[model samples]
Target: MFSGAQISLYPMADDFVSVIMAALTGLDPWREALRIETDDISTLLVGPPEVLFAAMRDLFVRAAQTGVHCVLSAAVSRGCPGEPDDPICMAQGGFARDLALPDRIAAARANVGLAAVTGQDVAAQFSLYPLGEGPHMDEIYGCIDFLKASGTFDRSKNFCTRLRGDAGPVFATLCEAFTNFGTVAGHVVLDVTVSANSPSAR
Candidate 1:
């Protein structure tokens, strides 16, 4: 299986460059575990789900901690048919593919419950796509059920769901939503945008 994310970070400040560069240090701990490549447009992180989401959380939190409004946009995907299998992408202790939908939902919730608290408040909205054949809506609705009970769920929007809470649980929730639904070897994608310190919130 191959898993990765294309992410872009925006800092609402004049010194955006400095903020982004400094915040990149947050990925240091995860570097050995992930393949990180940066370009002018976005950064690509290829790795296991556990390390992937944590890296994103750390990077975003570091930027937000600069007291600047920061937004993180990510296109996360796993098991893309077009991508070759990568040994480094192997994950440990994830829900089995044959698990019932309800069972997966429960496991996802339990995973989110153990997330580390980062104490950084953030708002996020995301859409999960379980591509390919199978009971897609059932999977989505199951994800919704998990989200409603996630303690971070804010509301349901037109094409996405919103969540608000400390960065830890919020990111954890996103991670579970990404990993739990859909066939384990099927293509799955998640579109996410997370914001902190936005002037609109103040």
Candidate 2:
């Protein structure tokens, strides 16, 4: 599968540079796992869905911990049928990617020590889209079912869910959804917008 994300971070503070630096520095550990390129506008991360989302979780959480009111905008896509994957994406196939998800989540949990003024909760909205010629709606429902059953869902919110404690497990669930949908139904894409320490903060 060909997966990539174009992400831009907005740190709401006077010293935005430091906040951004902290977040980018956090990603250094995942550099070996992902292919990252940062330009003026946004950073492009290309790799498997699991690694890409996991890295995003780690990077965004670290940035938000600066207490600078950070908002991350990411357009993530995967499982493009005929699209040619970058070298980094192709290079990820040798190892067992499934086993790595749990390890990544554990690593993320150990790193998060920042206390939030409101509380340490992560919320996200996801729209899973299944492509290609098949029963896409069924696959989409299956993924959503998995998400809801995981006990992390806030069904009251429209197109959104909240993870009250560790962001790692929430991300792990998302990665599972992406992996399952794509592997079973073929081409799939997930449109996600995640926020940590959101403005509402209730």
Tens-digit lDDT track of model 2 for 1-202: 5778888888878998888888887687778878888899999898866678768877888887776677777777776767775666653422222333344333323323321222335666666676778767665565555565554566634654444445666665666556655344256676666677667875
In model 1, where is the ten-residue run with the lowest total lDDT?
Answer: 90-99
Which residue segments of model 2 deviate by more than 4 Å? 90-120, 156-165, 183-185
Cα lDDT of all candidates, in order? Answer: 0.93, 0.64
Task: Give the total clashing residue pairs for model 2.
Answer: 0
What residue runs in model 1 are displaced by over 4 Å at the alpha carbon? none
Candidate 2: residue pairs that collide: none
Residue lDDT tens for model 1, 1-202: 9999999999999999999999999999999889988888999999998889999999999999998999999999999989999988888655545789888888888888999999899999999999998789998999999999888999999999999999999999999998898877789999999999999998
After the best TM-score superposition of candidate 2, give how far the Cα of residue 100 lies from its true spot, in angstroms. 22
Error of 1 at 69 (Å): 0.6
Residue 186 of model 1 has an lDDT of 82
lDDT of 1 at 53: 94
Task: Write down the TM-score of every candidate.
Answer: 0.98, 0.76
